[model samples]
Target: MSDYDSGDELLADINAESIVAGTKRDRSESAREVQLSKRPKVEDADFGSTGSNSNDEFVEHIAKTTLKENFGFDQFRHEQFSAIKSILRGENALVVFPTGAGKSLCYQIPAVAFEKIDAAKNGRPHLGSGITIVVSPLIALMKDQVDALLRRGIAAACIDSSKTYEQQQLTTAAIREGRLRLLYCAPERLNNEGFVESMKHVPGGIRLVAVDEAHCISEWGHSFRPDYLKVARFIQEIKAERVICLTATATPRVADDVARAFEIDKSNVFRTSPYRPNLRLLAESVSTKQDKFPKLFKFLREHPGSTLVYVTLQKQAEQLADDLKDEGFHVAAFHAGLKTELKAQIQDDFMASRIPIVVATIAFGMGIDKADIRNILHFDLSGTIEEYSQQIGRAGRDGKPGHCMFYICPEDFYLRENFARGDLPSRQSLRRLLEDLFHRDAVHTPEGDVIKLNQTTLGRTYDIRASPLAILLATLELRFGLIRAITPEYSSYQFEAMYNYYRVVKDDKSQEGKAIFSNAKKAQKWHHIDVNAAARSTGLLRADVIRKLNDYNDRGIILLKASGVENRYKILKELPSTPQEMDAITDKLYAEMETREEDALRRTQEVADLITGDACFALALAQHFGMGLPDGKTKCGHCTHCLTGARVVLPPRPAPSVDMVGIQKILDVCHVRDDPRFLARIAFGIKSPRVFELKLHTKKVLASLEDHDFSSLLREFTKACEAANFGAGTS
Candidate 1:
């Protein structure tokens, strides 16, 4: 061989050796391109920079230029400019701003700014090459954002179940080819392996990961979804370049949770005021369900404009929409059960002012961007203040005067409680099911025949039910290797043998008895092979086979799938006589259920109190979030309570007067001190709950007794009592 040929041969041998050694070359390392050099430094070139110029100055300057050149907006609202600057600096931030406060712009502008910076440094800017992944909880919101961006001539796309398989593949290709800049996806999609892999291959990598509705990540947050727990791991896996968590409602606790989830500095968190002065909060007590409709109708008739009527159930939403339509009102019903196309049409109609009133369930409003809504009416009591606030926040987005009214009936509390209970499974049922799944096994005969060995029948199985059994199947999928579970999708699974014995036996059939012998052997072979395959596929160990089989039967898998076969034997993994551990598990399950119930109840009460309280609406809301009011007073004078004389105050009062007749009348009629204060305190002069609790007919008599202001009513009442010869200790 020539010298050149020998050198080529040696190189080829080395490559072959590396391949055979199972050491695969890292694709990422191999694909690395030459890093571009930094731009040349300008010599005393201000670039329009001033003495006060900062990194943020460049960021803001770039953002403003992009806004005017791209989106055609002249200014940033509230903290939009600062937030975008923070994000561009690669600092994690939690932005708590009201709806329509331009939260999306915070992330969108920074993404554009970063892309521009890359362009200014290099000769060419790769549009949509800089990845900005937005993780939104609402599918509707994702669609809305994608559509809005596309309208702005921006390359944006969202991947959700609504897309067809071909469309998904096309979008995935678009992302890989760097044809899409902003990618919006639901949290569930983040867990998808293919989607994650596609993101890794995208050019420029993900520069920013923005989580919308970030409060959902916290257990203390009102709208807690268990799936949000996976977000941290997802960020870590993708090597999140930067994270920005945005929420309209977050208590200090929820803010902390968001910080922890995003690994953001707590000091970097920015929160806008939750209080909206334009929103007029009102609450009315309804004696019964019959009273709610009239009150709602009255409110609608009084203040008519684009409105959202939130109900708890689909049926209620539909029924109420019908009732409102009957009242000559334009209305549309929206719920999750409705067709997606229809729901979208309804939402479009509502947004376009084609439908003035959209009666909807909670599912409809998560991502709704209707800014002209003048009223938000709650058909029934909401489960929590967080939900109430979110629903009410839909209105007054345009800074116009809006009204929010709640018609509360005490019975609604029970209905909400029942709904919460329905989510939890009974401990006894779960324990029994777990006990069956944990202990099971199988044995095979020498002739490739299988003998059923378990409490469950080899041939009989049960049907799947929609109850605690679904939860059990989910637990099993996570713990054992029986099935794979996907949330908000397929909640259950079916057991099917992976291998086919018929194909194996088909080849051997020719060697069996030619006629009669062949037929008998085939029959025996079928029985043995079928049983053995079932046994092997179950993955149950030999000792616990019987119990698992029993569980399968109890769950109705055997009876439902494998009918007409019953041969089964018991195989215990270990002596199943540990009642103590079983009891502990049961206790734990019960405690969890109880905790959920308690949280639900507490949430209900808090919402109810907020609606009924006499304190300023803004202050009450701020206090709930652990924010103190500017002034120490309980009343803000800006809310309905302060505007009306119903606000309670402890002003200076006059000395006691001697009026026996009025004192006797007040004591005889009033039960609560506030009740008499409302009557005699304003007249005879008293300030107490008893006075208000009782409806004393002493307005005329008490007024005749004293001309003191309402503030001095209590002192006047005390003098009247003394004049009536009642002891100082007596009422």
Candidate 2:
């Protein structure tokens, strides 16, 4: 049986009380214990024995000791203790705590405990000679956590794109030498064959796996990352003993999805209420875009500590920060578009309290742990309730009074809805994608027929954004069971000889090895090879060429790196034959996309309802996460709804009319792309990949009608396309 089997007998055992010698219990409890004690005790060789209640005290003691010794904590909170105990007991868990609720300790403490226990048992400080792997999406967060752990005399290291190749090699050596108790990496690193192979050689194998921000694995989550879907396969491949999934903003649906993905039992799911009484939730109405500044200026003058003002667009962040600076406020704009060095400096300044106010998009607050942020002002509506909850949760983390204000306007809502609608690809594009994939060459493998896909090329050809394209492929795999995802492969590898190239080539005399080394083109000092090209030229199989390259890297003869990653999938079923059959599949996939789009728009509407409704604000937010305030209290008593008993009503603006003359001029000048959606995007000022590719952002006529409603502009562009006798297309 699998480790996570949830049968009736296991359920009975879980509910039974502990059996101790020389102890008395109630009749019912004694009967339950006797029944459970009759079952065979299965001892696990790698992990501790299952259902070993005798070790509970030891686990609790070690957890507390580690907490105090390594992290300087006197105790673990109830949620943290339960999750940590389960992990030490070799059980899977899903931990959902509010932001700033010490979720990191839940996993970090257990990682330390694993090492401490192993050291005591075998005179070595590692988990059965293996390391705990932490899958975190934030590179900065990984570095920060690793640094903090190292400061506390714990062995921890992170491997990410920010690290140099030499640094990564050093980390690899640490892993092999059993020096690292914990390893942190991004979700996409699971696709790195070299890293995975290195991990496979660990003495015992991977110990415990913790997936932070695990909600990204759920499609229902607000920030779904397709790479997270591969984590389950990664666990299976590595034969990990236990898994723990952690997140701060997962809804109940997302929580269930994550738990099922990791095989976490329902009883092992842990959560803490998101209600923080110290935060005062408030909202106000804005009549026009220009009317917001006066209110914002007034609020900033009143609340002066470190503040975060969130905007919807990157340009909006810059403009708002500039306007605030004009008012003599020390402020800076933070967004993904900023230079890396500048962003790092800005973050440092903010953390050090040098920048009192930061105007930023949603990208600013992922790993930020500032404790004294006094105010969080939303200059625009958040994308979802989860997003709002997370952003506001960043405030008042120190338990002092923090004020959160939302500026509500009809324009922001309309824009968010349009963005959700704009994300869906056209049906024609989906059909084209299906036809292209179904016609691709299939390689017969033992499991099934595998097809390789260049995601970049496919996305560009079909006008699908990367996220939507990922969702489409995932729908095919999970929803329809048409394909099973496999490890993606890089098209080529670039390597430089470790020492003298001539000496190394002369030493390797095998036919495939000589062909690979000699045929590889030399540019400067590095030799680059396209494995497929070399295979065809030498009449050798591609697998043989790659194996030789990997062998060279393994033997330290070459420093190798791979690039141009292509996704691979094994087909599970036959392809559709008739056009009608193809259309059926395409329409189902398109409907899946539509469902997600509608879900996003619904979340936007929920945020609007939260602001405009009369319910207690904090209670409403908690209820959204399938919880209530502590002590069964329904009202927070400190929110705007509780204090004022007034709802914020944002008056709607009049519908915008189309400008025929401006539209004609745009059509006349912007002839680079005939797709109606592309024209609509230009008119609505939504920048897409094709817009930059066509250099349309520089056109003065583009976005001339950006002030108008996006839906109205899209309709106008579609009519224009039809009138011009060209059928409708998409971008």
Candidate 3:
């Protein structure tokens, strides 16, 4: 008990024992419980709901019984049984079923069955049970599903930003003790080191990982989320036993991307056609944006059913909802920017049939489970075929007729195309990012060369949006293998004792904890510890100090908060050392960005073509997913093209022109973000976060040339910046 005379001596002894030179310490904790063996083959065991049990019969019996007992269903929907069978057999599966096809049940039933089957085999609960980790996209979806599961007496939980630290700790503790059967989280949680470290020590390891909305993993897919790209890597790191990738819509090419990422076999891929016979596709051409209101009103009055009116922007949703409400229509606006409580209330109102029409952006309908939505109206062009399919699939879940109408106009096309073109970062910004990576930013550490990136600051400085910057960083880690991201850490920690401060120091038995607590500087009611200063003073690793403090917080000895988070990356290989080498690397990256930009434009055009083309509407839409008409029929007789027998032409947009006065007004705002790309974004009306923060979007000068080509505006801005000596030597 008495190894040293003083706390300083104790700390020095501990530091010497923990610190290693020129090598990265493994941060993963050792498993406390033994790993369980794989499930016994069903043929070798007598495990079934009834007395008789064959391999297939036993699995089917358990699945059906679990479904009946847990989810209250007597029969399996199309392809659900097959997908669940693959999962029960411990094989990776890719499910490309349409929306409302019970995809959630495919994984949820299996999750519960794992424990039930184990209990059946041993005549008791397994000693070290594994849990299923579900990667979902939305926090609201997570909460909804978790609540539903809990109501069914299933132990399920979610980890998301909305939860308090105390709640997260409770969930984490439940996961470690095998008290939970299913855990839901977003794909970004895989990058969280604290969560990853906790998963490393889970009782029997993660048994199954279900990736919901799995098409987001594919950049080729319409709804490509960059965070989804890291899912396969996360799965490998966790070494989960089985995985099921589920999506409501995926093209053949997108399916391949998902399969390749998860190592799913060709035979394991299951597809139920996304085509719904009950839903009719309709299209109309509008002369102007103002014309959509009367047409929408007329349709809604005729239908008088729950409807979702899709819009392109959040403000448009608000404006439309206001206009409709002023016209004495019961409606609400739903978008991502709304407060959490308000969104929940809106969701409740919509589900309860209090609001019949919701004018919303793309964020409204991911996890809502209402069944009788009768109409889905697109007030603007859908961003892509995949998006249109997924959105419209939300209708007619109860096997009733659902009408889907698309209103197309020339201005909609221009607006969407302008956004697509503005998404790319300029070539100069890419070069600047490379320079910072290889030069002023790199910091040498024991593990490797570390670069601390302030993502917001860097985004503004280079005129790169966060998603694109995330993609660029991910490219460095995944595509090139030149770097790997480490856990981001705060520069400082602020904590206060739950009770007496001295009592905390006395309770912490570890010397590292003692040093950390003793060194915290008291400022008013709270105590602050500069993590870097404490590391140097105590001769402890930064990770070690952070761990102990988090441990203290977990034990309820202190309330903790941390700030100044730095996104750290460790260089895995030598970066380009020469100017020529740097140029070559940057050029390749910029070219890829351009390729992505072109692909976005192509997708936008595909939507335009879908509305105006002479082909049968339903057949062309089905062909996008690589399918044909039902029963070898040449035409879906209900679609607009088949019924009308004529193409609907959209009105043409005006020629591109920019006012010189408006251009100068935009340039005046460029002093805040002096980069030429930033100037061009203002001129073309692209809302980067910094631009939004500056409230530039509210100005009329912004988007002055929104009808003009983005590349042309970029060239114009570059010339203007050089002529005015604006942002000189900044690049």
Candidate 4:
């Protein structure tokens, strides 16, 4: 026989005998002993197993020769290279791998690869004009990613509201000149006319649009933004060469929305499993807010080293921080409303290890990459599972063991439910307001009938506040198919001087004429105030209102007669009667508003439900993008529900303690008392950078105390510190 045939036959015979001997071995004898006793020696011709070693060598060779030569990588973890290669091949990929799975590298490597390919073909010595546009939801996130890219010697920039006009101009100019390879911008910025124009000239015309936190685009996704709907049109207009959407958390529904927004083919999508075996998720429901502190104290005492505590409101965060500090813990608080510079300082302190715990709201944890956090605790239950997953994902990022505990209170559910209803107007109230406007001829009749009345005449005719009247009119014009409301313009002038001018001119006229002129001036001032009010209510720019007024003047519907005041104008239109169908129209409009309000509330609840459901977070996220989940196979084991039974259960615990020393420690770490919640968040280890930058290390200490009664622990710690003359007998 040939050599290969002989070798195969010999190996097969040896393996057969080994299997037979193993099966027939004594019950008490070791399996390893039996296998070794019957096994053939390595030098024997029958002993050959080279496939596994060959695969390893092949992988190693590729890592050293191919990867290192091209992307400067000596090794790759599971699924990293494959995902990167898939993206490079222009496939629509959805990577659901756990946090710290080298997700950024999946797209970053491909981005570099594309840059290389373009440079090679163009005979360029440097990286070419291929641009990757990343649409991030948060301004902070955009800044963070850009900063990271800059640190890596990559050209990146972000355009957001926080940037000054000069900064924006510079960024836009750089983009047009092809100096920027990656441009991070918020979805809202896409709606700005000036920003949109700047993107058109991006050097290579946007080779790829990578959407970070893509779940925000899907209405069905847990964190939906209304403005995200415009991303699709923006992408099409820019004609992005390729699209890659990325998110740390997403359900199937959210995934579909993302795909639709990018106009990507569903078949090209790629998703990794969301199951994180390294994380341990736990939830404890407390009976009351008063009971939470004690439980939290017990947890802190039980676990040592880095921990995060999450709370919803700023005041609660602050109060908790203060209480914990009084109990002798180093904590800080973080929130969005704080000044930018101060927030940065707090974050710096936390990262530098000055603060160990941070009490914070949802504002603190986006795009942060601190890997040493050992625990995450929620003082209050999160509104949705998507948020819960994201919060917990911050833990165990270093591939180390970490604990995530959530404290659930039933009352917190009501608070969350109320928050969900904050966005939309109440349908009943809206309907009533619409009805009043329609009846008063503020809106046009449904049958194309016009209600022609001067502002002064309308104000006199309805005895209602002029601002609310104008708001109703504008709302009807913009939101409903009502009579188009046109702004009338009168030339604005300094009121006192204009009043004198009118008197001088009317000196030759009759008493009746003088009276008419004086009354008109008064009405003009009131109208200006009303207009400002309208601008405030509708969230429209004063410039837009002024432009509308100019258009009205051009139409000759109203005369802008100068008055002696800065924006005061006299109305010239003759009073017109209300239309015949005004009442019917008003009733219809009001009913519509009521329905809209209800619809908004329902939508909010629906969002909450989608987040709390059993579907895979990644799959639900995919479905949001108009892409269906490949199959319902992936489950994120890191989620609270997945870890601690589908339904959350509370453990019986005693009353909570307010630790004065812990509260003081938190305050010391916070440094800024503007946002109290920020301090509370740090004490609980909620992952606020303010806490991290302060070098707070109370998470470990607090976790160790979690199993005990919080109040008792606080009292005991305080007493011990007092006895030991700690902080000059501060207790």
Residues 13-48 of candidate 4 have per-residue lDDT tens digits of 111122222222332225423432343211221213
**Candidate 2 C-alpha error for residue 630, in Å:** 2.3
Work out the TM-score per prediction.
0.65, 0.81, 0.85, 0.56
- Cα lDDT of model 2 by residue, 413-468, tens digit: 66786588567766777898999888888988554789999888887777777778
Ranking by TM-score: 3, 2, 1, 4
With candidate 4 superimposed using the best TM-score fit, by how many Å does residue 257's alpha carbon deviate from the native? 2.2
Could you tell me how far off, in angstroms, the CA of residue 430 lies in candidate 3 after the best superposition? 0.7
Off by over 4 Å in 2: 1-53, 118-129, 164-166, 193-201, 442-452, 481-578, 656-683, 690-731
Candidate 3 lDDT, tens digit per residue, 186-254? 776666655665565455567789999899999898878777888898887777878999998888999
Model 3: lDDT of residue 84: 92
Model 1 stretches with alpha carbons more than 4 Å out: 1-26, 29-53, 123-129, 433-590, 628-638, 647-731
Candidate 1 per-residue lDDT over residues 329-440, each given as its tens digit: 8899998888767887998899899999999888878777778899998888798777887888899888898888777765566456545544443343455644554444
Superposed on all Cα atoms, model 1 deviates from the true structure by an RMSD in Å of 18.7
- Structure candidate 2, residue pairs in collision: none
